[model samples]
Each structure stands twice: as structure tokens, then as C-alpha cells.
Target chain A: MPVKLYIDAVREALWEEMERDSRVLILGEDVGVRGGVFRVTAGLFERFGEARVIDTPLAESAIVGVAVGASAAGLIPVAEIQFADFILPAVNQIISEAAKLRYRSNNDWHCPLVVRAPYGGGVHGALYHSQCLEALFTHVPGLKVVAPATPHDAKGMLKAAIRDPDPVLFFEHKKLYRSVRGEVPEGDYTVPLGQAQTVREGEDVTVITYGMGVHWALAAADQVAAEGIRVHILDLRSLRPLDEQAVVAAARRTGKVLIVHEDHKFCGFGAELAALICEQALFDLDAPIQRLAGPEVPAMPFCPPLERAYLLNADRVAEAMRRLARF
Target chain B: MMEQARHRRPEAQWRGSGGEVHEFHEVHPGEPPRHRALGLDDAQAVEMYRYMLLARLLDERMWLLNRAGKIPFVVSCQGQEAAQAGAGLALDRQHDYLLPYYRDLCLVLLWGHTPRDELLAAFAKAADPNSGGRQMPCHFSDRKLRIFSGSSPVGTQIPHAVGFALAAKMRGEASVSFVSFGEGTSNQGDFHEALNFAGVHKLPVVFFCENNKYAISVPEHKQLACANVADRAAGYGFEGVTVDGTDALAVYQVVKRAVDKARHGGGPTLVEAKVYRLVPHSSDDDDRSYRPREEVEEARRGDPLVRMRAYLTEVGLWDEAAEVDLRQRIASELDEATAFAEQAPYPPEESLYWYVYGEEETSHAG
Candidate 1:
């Protein structure tokens, strides 16, 4: 096994997949010569040439819309939105066109498009650059949403997304791109979509989270272990078509569940997780479901104090876990 | 009655130095016929006229069905039949892809959609090949015929057409993607974005704007800040042409040239077909609310079907017997389609849950 950064894992997936299948192409702003704004797609343009690594105009709508059309025409298109906040202009293309193509055509036409965007806050990227929009796409029925927390998951899930017969939204946490590192398998492998994995097992409380929140929960679990309060952690790799069985099983194991995410606490992905937990394992719960998420502000502010106060960390997760354990 | 009205109106004339307006009859006293000059033989010209006539009859029948409370909606292609039929016939239907808007009955028919298929979709029957009763009427799609599925969101199909062209270029195929929309749709951001992308990439796609003057009550002057939709193509670095949509031969010549240029790697073209909507926007709309009734009656005088028929008759390829026989044949086909669609069953209740995702693993596994 070789250790790799989360961003490198994603790059490797693109490099390997494009090498394996000539139909796999990348299109977005600065993806050709510049190798993407964050260097996530670095060196791909040089290797695959201009035809596969397309550099599009500054329009987000065209980037996604063209991908939708190309996917239907038997080419695997992986479109990139420069930032998650800027993806609003392409909501119509993503939600209305790509999401409904197969269903509207009655399976006569399908869009195998993968739209990747750098999301989440932490590196002083306030407001516009730092936002989690996975919840918005998760609400769309025909689209599959995924957020990978580790290098292993990022590489495998991206390969799966590119291979999917339908449209997929792959949200990469910008903060974890270079910060997270783990051992990734050398050869081709895939982490199936719509499945959840239990990272840490315990007998006290279960912390369900994804993306950046997953790392925070794991740290909190380790910190709380000193106090004899064992914590269970479940990383939900797939948001849409949620792993209901794993969610319920995690809830039933410890009888105390705490949901965590960086999105708004109101109507966030955590709310859906809470609803699913209560619906399936309501009687198994020893205490009420606890949710730890960002405050309901419009977005993350610029200043360090305000930004720190807005985002969740290991201390915040530990405090929430302590409160739930006391209950 | 129509012949008497035709004799009443003055001879249609071409004006403007820019060629924005075209003469109704392209055959001058001494020169060759316009269709012959455009490389269309006698049979091809007659077939174009027949397609325009079939579209008119089919559209008129849809209106009757709507008025009789038999169908839910009617989006007429009354005044733009020449633009549809002529441009459609010019494409290499065997290899090209069509992304048509709602008012493209004639174009889809030229691409292999039969009168019965249109009727089945209009009735929202189970056998409807477009959407299996899921979409509204005129939202065309047929995988076998290479007609890309379109939605009601006006200009969204523009980029999709560009994508098809992009794929064709990538695969080293000489396929052109043809897309059509109304004049108002040119204002959409997707339209500009799609055109710019296609221009930069030199993709093989054609952006056809059937400028029917009004986009559901908003007149052309109110919709555009420039003189013509075709003029906007210059900003994207491409050739743009404006032609009279009522003259089938003129439209055929322009579209054929554009398609040929695209297939040879010359990039995209913006073609604006100046025409009119001969009816209200849809069955639910009432033209009396905004425009005067006389304006619509005036537009009916330049109907593409009527103009194409007159051209065919002048060229000695059509006569009273030919007209009567064509109408009789279309009437029987329309009658049979109506009866079959009216009795066709709606999609099954459980079908609503199907096709949301593919059932099998269509992924390219390593």
C-alpha cells in the first residue's frame, strides 16, 4: 500500500480511468493547461492531451449542460464546477436536465455525467469559496451524491461515479484535499455507491457524519475514550440513496445517536439522517437523537473568530458527544 | 375559398437590400426555378411540399382535438412549416442528430416521426415513443431515430446539441448536431454560453432560430436589442444568415450549405428563419388578449404550407388532382391515427416508478 493525499487519490482516479477508457474526458475552466485551479487535475492535460482534458469558458451552465449532452452521446464526461458556491448558475442544468433525462425519456436516453466541485470551509476561504451544496443535489431524486472523507474513499468513489450509468455529484472537501492522507490500494478498485462504513466501533454513543465532520468525530471519539465514554463513528460516504440498514444498525448498537455535518442545521443532510434513524430504530434509542451542525447563518463569515465560531471542530464534537452521553 | 383569398391579396414582394425579405415566388420569367438552382429535383421539391402539407393538416387536427376536449394541449407549427420541412430535409438524417423545440412537428416528421407517433404522444398513450406518457406533448425523443430528448425549458437544448457535436468530434465522426428554438430563447444565458463554447471548440452544430415574431405575446422588437438573432453570431466568430421562413427552397439552400460546412469542420452557424406564428401560443392561450385578430389573419396569408403549395403548382409538379389526392391521403392517415390514439391505453400505474435509475449495471467495470 502507498500513502497518498486525498487530492492525489482523486487525480490518480482520473488518470487511471482516462487511460483505461478513452471516452472518459474532463471539461471545465482552467482544467487544460493550468491543470485546474486547485491542481487536483494536475498533469492530466499534458498526458491526455487537449481533446480529453477540455478547457471550457467561464460559464458554469455550459460546463454542466455540455456534459449532459456529451454523456447522452456515449462519451463519459466529468464536468467540474470551479467552486460549490458558483454552481448555482448550473442548478437548472444539473437538477432539471441531467437529473430528469433518463426518467423523462423513460430510459431511452441517460446522462452518465460526473460533476465534481471543491466544497467545505476551514482554510480561511469565507462565504463564496467555502460552502457545502451536497444537500441541494441530494434532494434531487435522480442524482447520486457522494462526499468522501479519506484518500481511499475519494479515489474509489470517484471511479465508481465515472462508471455509473447515471449522473453523479462528487463533492470534495477542499480543506481535506492535502490535509488528509491515507494508504490507497495500488490497482483498480471501487467503493460502491450508496453504502456506509463504520470506521470505529463502541458500546456507548454513535457519531454519524461525513466529509470533514467524519475526521472531527473520530478525533472526538479518541478524546472521549479517556473519560471511559466509548464512542462509535459511522462515516456516511453516500448521501443520497442513503445506507438505511447501516444507519439503523449503528443506531441500535449503542442506543445513542448524534448526527454531524457542516451544512445548515435546519433541513440539512443531518436532518434526513435523523429522520431515518428515528423511523427505523426509534425504540432502540436510549436517548433522543442529537444533531451537531453549523449555525443557521447565510454562510461562513470572513474573520477568524466568526469563521471559527461558525465551523465545527473536534472540541465541539467532543462537547456534543459528552452532552449526549450524559443524557 | 383559399384560392379566392389568394387572388384577393397582392403578389408577395421581396424588399430590403440585406435580403431579410425574400420573394414568395423565386422563379423569375427567364431564369431557372429556385429549387432547381438549389439542387433540388422535381421529386424532392414535391416531397418537400407534401411534408409541409402533412404538417399543416396534422397541426390543424391537433387543434380540433384540443377544441373537442379530446387532448390536453396544442402547440401549433402552422406558420413555420417551410422552415421545418426545408431545413429538416437538408440534413443528413442518417447520421445527424435533431434537438427540436415544441413547434417542430414537420422537422421531426422529416426525421422519421410518423403522424401516428405524434398522435400517440398527444394522447399520452402507453405506446408513445417520446416519453411513455411522462412528458407533455411535443417534447420529442426517439433513440432509434437520433432525435435527442428535449424539455420545455426553451434554450437548454442548445448546449446539449453542442455536446453531441463535441462527442462526434471526439469519436472522429462527421455528425452534425442541429437544434431549434424561438427568437426569445436567444436571450437565455444558456444560448450565449452554448454558442460561445461551440465557437471556441469549432464543434459541428447548427443553431436554428425560428423567429416567429412573438414569443407568446412578447413581440420580436421587445425580445431583441439588435436587428436580428443571426446578427448575434458575429460576436461568437461565425457566419450567420437570415432567410424568409416562408420560402422552403431558400431555407433549404441556406441550411444545406450550413450543414455541409459543419460536416467539413467549418464549425457552427446561426440561422434565423424570419417567420410568424399563425395561431395562439397554445391551446390554453388566447391571441385576442394581446394582438389584434387582423394581424393573425395577415400572417395566415404568408403561411408556409400555402406558399410551398403555390410554388409546387407553378413549377408544373402539382395540380388540382394532385392537391386533392394528397389531401385525401393525409385525411385518411390523420383519421386512422386519431382513432388508434383515442382508444390507446394510458401508461400503467407502476410505470411511474420505473426508469428513475437503470435497473442493470451499465457501468464499465474493470
Candidate 2:
């Protein structure tokens, strides 16, 4: 097993899948000769040739729209929206068109497409580039929103998304792309979608999180370990088809519940998780559900201190957990 | 009698882009660049006339139904029938795909949607083949027929159609996808993006712009600075041409050439059919507020159905008795379709959840 960065894991999956299936092609702005601005597709253009690794003009809506159409027509396209914020222009095509194709046409037509975007704050990407859009897409019925926090999950979830029979929106945390590294198994493997991972197991508090929040919760758990408090961090890798079993089990095992995420506090994914916990394991609760998430700001500002204050960090998670434990 | 004979060819002062003064004989006032020839024989010409007549009759009936509080809505295809039918009929039906907009009743009809299919959609009936009564009227779709179900958002279908072309090109197939929209829709960013992608990739697709003049009360002059929508294709580095939309044969000829070019891998083409809205934009709209009533009356003077009927009569392809028989036959068919749709059952109450996600996976979390 070789240690790989989160972005490298994503690239490996794309490269391996394209090599495995001739129908699989990559299309996005600067994805070909430029190998993507982030270089996640660094050598794919040279390896697969121009047609398979297409460098599209700067058009987000067309990129997704073409993928929807092409996917229906028999080709599997993995379209990349340069950043998460840029995907707004293509929401109509993804939500209104591709997502509805299967149901609207009564399964006569379907678009098996994947859209990958680098999301989250702390990269100093500021307002436009550091937004989390998983909640918005997760609300859509047909779409499957994937947010992988580890190198292993990144590779496995991306491969699974590519081979999925429906359209998938894969969000790769930009800060985790280079910062996080882990040992990835050398053979073919796929982490099943809609399953949660108990990254850390303990009994004092149940900290449910995903993406960068998982890493923060781990740090927070270590900090709280000194105080004799054990935190069980459950990484909800797949947001859309959330594992209700894991969410309920975590809530029941450790009644002290804390939900953490980088998305907004108002109507964020945490609210949904909180709702699920209430519905499935409300009587099991020892105290109220404590949510540690980004404030209801428009976006993360460009200033470093402001950006740090705007984002949810491990210290914040630890401090919130201490208060929940006290409660 | 001599003046009336010449009335068949309306003469107008035409200004070329090169600043040349010329006189052209038009079958209608806005008859595009060429209208002198058609490839259809006597019977085929008569069939084309019949389709236009049927489309017009269907449009009129839908309006009546809407007014009678029967159908929920009516998006008129009154002025663009000739262009839609012509371009639609010219395609290789067995292979090509269709992505028609809301104002494409005639195109969808020519693509094999029966009058009952349109009526069922209007009534939002259970057996409606397009969407199982899920979609609104005019959002035409037929999976078996390779028609993409379009949405209310304008220009979104352009890229989807290009995807069809992209698939064909990648597979090395000769199939092409035909997508239609109004002139105002061409102003959208997706339209530009789709055209640019198709042009760059050299995909097999036809972008047909039916310039019906008004996009919900906004005129052509207000929509774009370019002379015509087809001109935008040249900027995308593909072949583009504008033809007389009212002249069915001419539109057919131009679109046929473009389709051939695309199928053979020559690349995409943009076609603008300069059409008029003979009626209000929709049953709910009142054109009186925006433009003068005389403009609507003037457009009706060169109605495509009337012009096509005249052309057929001139070539000895149609007669008054044939017209009377065709009208009677279409009238009876319309009656049958309307009565059937009016009495059709609405979708079952539980059926609302159907098709919201994959049919196999019914357990969806809110």
C-alpha cells in the first residue's frame, strides 16, 4: 500500500476508470492540455488523448448539459466544474434535466454522469471558491451527493460514483487535497455508497461529521481524551443516501450528540442529521443535539483571520463538545 | 385577374448585407433569401400542406379548449408551423433525435406524436405517453420516438441535444440531434456555450432557431444586436444560414442540407427560420399591449398555411374539393381526440411519487 494525497486518490480513480472503460471521458475547463488548474488531471490528457480528456471552453452549464446528453446517448462523462461555486449556472441542467431524465422518461432514458468540484474553506479561496453545496444537491431526489474525507474514501467513492447508474455530484475538499494523506490499497476496491464510517470509537460523546469536519472531530477527540472524555466520530461519507442506521446507533450508544460540518448553520445538512436523530433515536438522547458549523454568512471572506473565524475548526469542535459534555 | 395572378408572388425591395439594392419575388412579405424552388413532388407537396393544415387546426382547437376551461394551457405554434414541420420532416426519422421546445406542436406531431398525444398531455391524463401526466402541456417528449422531454427554462435543451451529437461523434455513428427554440432563446448563455462546444468538437447536430418574433412580448430588435441568430453560428466556426420560414419547401431544403453536412461529420450548423406569431404568444397572453394590432393582422396576411396551400394549388397539387375533404377529415379526427382526452383519467393519487428517483430504488429519504 502506498500513501497518497486526497487529490492524488481522486486522480488515480479517474485515470484508472478511463483506462478501464473506453466510454468514460473527462470534460471541463483546462482539463486536457493544462491537466486542470489543480493538476488533479495532470497527465490524463497525454495518456488518454484529446477526445477522452477534453478541455472544454469556460462554460459551466454547457459542460454539465453536454454530460447529461452524452451520458444518455451512451457515453459516460465525468464533468468537472472548476469550483463548487461555479456550479450554480448548471443547476438547471443537473437538477431540472439530468436528475429528472430517468423518472420523467419512465426509465426510457438516463444520464450516468459525475460532476467533481473542489469545495470547502481554509484554502484561502475566499467567498466564491470555498462554499459547500452538498446540502443543496442532497435535497434533490435523483442526485447522489458524495463528500469523501479520506484518501481511501476519495478513491473508492469516486470510482463508485463513476460506475453509478445515476448522476452523482462528488465534492472533494480542496484543503484536504494536499494536506491529507493515507495508505491506499493497491488493488480494485470501492467503498459502498450511503454508508458511514466510525473513524473514531468511544463512549462519552457521539460526534457526527463529514469531509473536513471528520478530521476536526478526530483532533477534538484527542484533545478531549486528556480530560477522560471519549468522543466517537462518525464520518458520514455519503450525504444524500445517508446511513440512518449508523446515525441512530451513534445517537443511542452515546446519548451526548454533537453534529459538526463546514456548511452554514441555517438549514444546513446538520439540521437534517439532527432531524434524523430526533426521529430515530430521540428518547436515547442524554442532552440536546449540539451543532458546530459555519455561521450563516454569505461566504468565507478573503482575509485569513476572518476566513478562520468564518470556518469551523477543531478548537471550535472541542470547545462545543466540552460545553455539551458539561450539559 | 392579371394583378391577382401576380398576387401569388409578392414583390419586395430586398436589402442585401453588402448594401446592394435588389427586388425579390416572395410568396410572403418576410420570405427569406430564397423561395423559388422545392424538391417535393405533387403528392408529397400535398402531404406537407396537409401537415401544416392539421397543425393549424390543432392550434385553433387547443385555444378553444383553453377558453372553454378544459385544457390548462396553450402555447401557440401558429406562425412557426411551416418552419417546424419542414425542418422536422427533413430529418432522418429512423435515426435522428428530437429536442423540441414548448412552441413545437407541429414538430412533435411530425415526429410521430398523434393529436391524441398532444390532447392527453393538455389534459394531463394517466396514459399520456410523454410524461404520464407529469409535465405541463407543450413540454413534448416521447422516449420511444427519441424525443427529449424539455423544460420551461429556455435554451437548456441545446446542450442536451449537443450531447446526443457528442455521443454519435464518439461512437462514429451517422445520427444527428435536432433541437428547436425561439429567436429570443438564442440570446441565452447556454445557447452560446452549446454552439461553441458543438462547433469546437465538430459534432453532428442541428440548432434550429424558429424566430417567431416575440418572446413573451419582447420583439426581435430588442433581443439581439446581430442581424440574425444564424450569424452567431459563423462566430462559432460552423455553417449557418437563414431561410424563409413561411416557405415550407425552402426551410426543408436548407435544414436538409445542414443535416446532411452534420451526418457526414462536416460539423454542426445553425439555421434561423424567420417566422411570425400569427396569434398571441399563448392563450393567457394579450399581444395588444406590446405591438400594434395591425402587425398581427399583417403577419396573418402571409400565413404559412395559406401560402403553402397557394403553392400547392399553383403546381396543380391541390384543389378546393381536396381542401374541403382534408378539412372535414381533420375536423373529425380532432373531435375524436378532444373527446377522448377530455374524458381520460387523471394520474392516480399515489402516482405522484413515481419517477421522482430511480424506479428500482423507492426508499428515498426526504
Candidate 3:
């Protein structure tokens, strides 16, 4: 088994897709010559040529709008927005145009597009670059949101999103792009969208999380197992059509549920999962749903101490697990 | 008879006053004969007139529905009929695409969309094809006709249109895309960005601005200091043309030439149709607050529909009796469409999950 990083998996997936289909293209600021600020699209311009791997102007709105038109014209465009925080400028394209094209046209016209960006905190990217806007997109009806936690899932999910017929907002965790590694197959493969992957299985309690939080949930599961309490860790690969069935069944079997994410608690993805549990599996719950998420901090500070306090890590996940065990 | 045949020749003939007749031909330099290549004829003109009138009638019906509280929102496309219907007739509906704004019901109707779809969308009915009753009235969209969905937000569709046109270029198809917006859209940043990309890539897209004098209540004079919206195209390094929007023939001629240029790989063009706003921007807006009664009253003389009716009469293709019959036929067609739409069932609430993606991708557990 080879240890391939999530960033490498992303690059590999893009290369394979571009090679596989002439309709597939890549575009963003600094993505071509500089190989992307984070190297997610590195070496693609050299391999695919300038036409396929376009180095666009520093305008997020243009990047998204161009991709929207290209997709409508029968091209499979994958646009990189550089940072999730900067995606606000093009949020109109995502929420209004890309998300609603198929629904508005009654499936007559489809915008088969993907907007990929590096997101989440850690490595001290400061306030502007380290925010999670998945919940904002997940609330939108026409968008399918994907947040992969590992290298294998990253590559598989990217392939699936590229092949998807509607618009997909693929959120790549900047912290996990290089830190997380696993063995990925040699050929092209795709993990189905909106399907949650069960990373580790246990019986006592269920820890539902995604992206960076998936790693922390697994760590908490290990720490709790040593303390005589078992936990099931579920990583949600896609957010929009959430794996509500898996979430409810896990809560019913384990009798306790802990939802974790790096986003703030207010109107976060965790809140949606909790509501789904309350709506479907309320009687099966042993206690109220607990969420281990980033504190309600307006901005992520550059200092290590403040940043640590603002984000959810393994220690916080362990604390959440202990609380669930007590319940 | 020999003299009559010689006089009918298309070449210029010297007159007794030493002036040339300047026989009617293609106006541009290095251009070939227009009638032989374009194959345009009287039938196309008749179609354009019918579509333009249909658009106007549908817009009038929408306003009535709004006043009666049957529809939540309405954006009328009055007085801009020539620009909308002329451009619609010039493009290939099956191949060419339209990235329209909210006030594009006329354009969409000209591209083969039924009046029932407009009414259903206006009423936000369950069977509303535009947005499944989720979006407001006048936001037109139809996939079969290649009409892109319109949004309430300004200038977003400009870039989308460029991308679609670029895609067509990439596929080696000769299709061109046309995007329509009001003069107010020129102020938005997306408008500049879309134009810049379209110019740089030489994408086959036409950036059309229906300069309807006022953006909501703000007059064009206050919006900018430029001479006309077409003049702005020079900055983007493309050909810009302005035509009298009230004259359907003039708008048709200019847009048809531009559309031909784009399809032939000549690059993008900016066309500004100078028309008057005959109705308030939307049902919610009250133009009386900002626009003077005298201005509105005076602008009525240059109405596109009335001017087109005059043209039809001049061509001997229409008269008062024929106009009455045409209106009755259009009204009857609209009535049939309305009855069909009202009888149609509302969309099932359970289907709120379908079509978010393709059918093969809809099996998400959550």
C-alpha cells in the first residue's frame, strides 16, 4: 500500500478526468503557471495545455460565471476559487445560477459544473482564508456539497463531482490536503455523491463528522475505546442530500450522538444533522444531540493559542466523547 | 420594356441631375450581396411581427394579472419588443442560446415558449416550469428552446453567456449566444468582467442592452455620462451598433448582421437598442414618483408596437381588418394555453428532491 496525500489525489483525479474527456477543463487565478496557490492543480497546465488548464484573471465572479456558461454549452468545467472565503464574490453564481439552472428549466438545461476551493483552519492562514462555508451552500437547493476527509475519498469524490450532471461545490480541506494520506487505486474511480462513509465501527456511541473533523472523530474513537467506551465514526462525504438514514440509524443503535465540524455552531452543518435526528429518531435517543464545533469566534486569529481555542481538534472531540459516554 | 429592365438593374445609374441612385446593396465594405447569402424574405418579417405582437400581448396580460393579485411579481417587456423579437428571429433557437435577464419574457416567447408557461410562472403555480413555483414571475427559462434561466440579480448572466458561447466555439459549432440586460446592468462589475472575457477569448456572444431610458425609476441621463450604451463597446475592442428600437426593421437588420458576424467567427459584438420604457419596471414599482407624466405621454409616440404596425401596413401585408383578426387569433391561442396550464396538476412536493442533479445521481440517503 502506498501513502498518497489528499492533494496528490486531487491532482491525479483532475489529470485523469482531463485525459478521459475533452469536455473537462480547469480554470482559476494562479492555477495554471503557479500550479495553484496550494498546488492542488500543479503541473496540469503543462500536461493539458493552456486551453484546458486556463489561468484566469483574479476575479472569482468571472471564474464562476465563465464556468457556468461553458458548462451550459456542453463543457464540463471545474473552477478553482483559490480560497473558500473569496468565494463570496461568486456566491451568486453558485446559489442562483448553477444551483437553480436545472430546477428552473425543468431539466431542459443543465449546468454540469464544479466549483472547488481550499477551506478550513490550521497552519495559521489567518482570518480571510480559514472559513468553512459548506453550510451556506448546503442550504441551497440546487447544489451538491462534497467535503472529503482522506486522500482516497478526495480522489474518488472529485471524479464523481466532475462526472455529475449538476453543479457541485467541492470543498477541499487545506489542512488535510497534505496531512491526510491513504492508498488510492491506480485507475479512475468515483465514490457516489451524498453517501456517508463509515470510517471506524463501534457500538457505544456515534460520532458523526466530516472534513478535518473526521480525523478528530477517529482519534476520539481510539481514545474512548481505551477507556472502555466504543464509538462509531461516520464521515459525511456530501452535505446537501445528507446521509440522514445513516445518521438516524447510528443514533438509534448507539443511543448517543455527537456531531462535530470546524464551522461555528450557529446554523452549521451539525445543526442540520441534529434536526434530522430530532425529526426522525427522537424516541431512540438516550440524550440530546451534542455538537463539538468551533466556538462562535468572528475571526480566526493568527496567534496559536487563540486559533486553538477557536477550532475543534482531537482534544475537544475527546471531551465531547466523554460527555456522550456520561449521557 | 427595355428601359424598364435597365432601370431595375441594381448598379448605380447616373441621373439627369448628375446624382447617382446608389442602388440598394450591402452597406459594409468587402461585403457580398445580402439577399443571395442571407436568404431573408417577407415570411421572416411576418414571423417577426407576430412574435413581437405576441410578446407585447403577453406582457399586457401579465400586468393585468399582477394588478388583480393573481401573480406575485411582473416585469413587463413593453416598448422593447423590436429588440427582443428581432434578435430572437435572427438566431437559431435550437443551437443558439439566450442568457436573459428578468424582463425577457418577450424574447423567450419569440424563441417558441408558450404563453401558458409565462402565466404559470407568473402565478407561481406548482406546474410552473421556470422555478417550480419557487421563483417569482417573469423569470423565464426553457431548456428545449435553449433559453438560460434569468435571475433578479443584475449582470450575473453576462459571464454565463460568454461561457456558453465559448463552449460552442470549442465544440466547433457555429452557434452564438445572446445575453440581454437593461442599461442599469452596465454599472455592475460582472458586466465589465463578462465583456472583458468575451472580448479576450473572442467568444461568439452578443452583449445586448435594451436601453429602455430608465432603470427602475433612475433615468439613463443620471446612470452615466456616455453618449450611448453602444459607445461602451469600443472600449472592449469590438464593433458596437445602435439602432432605433422602435423600428422593428432597423433592429432586425442590425442584430441579424451582428449575429451573422459572430456565427462566422468574426468575434463578439455589442448592440444597444434605444427604446422607451412603456411600463413601470415591475408591478411593485411606481414610475410616477420619479418619471413625469408629460415624459411618459410624449414617449408614447415612439412605441415599437405601433411603429411595427405602421410598417406592416406600408408593406401592404396588413390593414385594420387584418390587425383585428391577428389579435383575435393570438388571444385565442393564449386562451387555449391558459386552459391547458390551469388543468395541469401541480408538481408533487415529494419531487422537491428530484432534478437537483441528474436522475442517475439522485439516490442520496439524506
Best by DockQ: 1
Write candidate 3's Cα lDDT for B150-207 as tens digits. 6778999899898988788888889899999989998887888888778877889988
Ranking by TM-score: 1, 2, 3
Residues B211-255 of candidate 1: C-alpha lDDT, one tens digit per residue: 999989899999999989999899898988888788787788888
**Distance from true position, residue B31, model 2, in Å?**
21
Model 2, span A91-209: residue lDDT tens: 99999988888777655578899999999989889999999988889889989898999999999999999998899999999999899999899977899789999999898899999
Complex DockQ, candidate 2? 0.70
User: Which regions of candidate 1 fall more than 4 Å away from where they truly are?
Assistant: B1-11, B14-25, B360-366
Candidate 2, residue A222: Cα displacement in angstroms equals 1.5
Number of clashes in model 1? Answer: 0
DockQ (0 to 1) for model 3 = 0.54
- Give candidate 2 misplaced runs (Cα > 4 Å): B1-38, B359-366
What is the TM-score of each predicted model, taking all chains together?
0.96, 0.93, 0.87
lDDT of 2 by residue, B2-106 (tens): 011112233233222321212223334554222334455556666677888888899899999999998888988998888887897689888999999998888
B5, model 2: CA deviation in Å?
Answer: 22
lDDT of 1 by residue, A246-286 (tens): 99999999999999999999999988989988888999999
* Residue-level lDDT for B298 in candidate 2: 69
Q: A261 in model 1: Cα distance from truth in Å? A: 0.1
What order do candidates take by DockQ, descending? 1, 2, 3
Worst 10 residues of 1 chain B by lDDT: B1-10
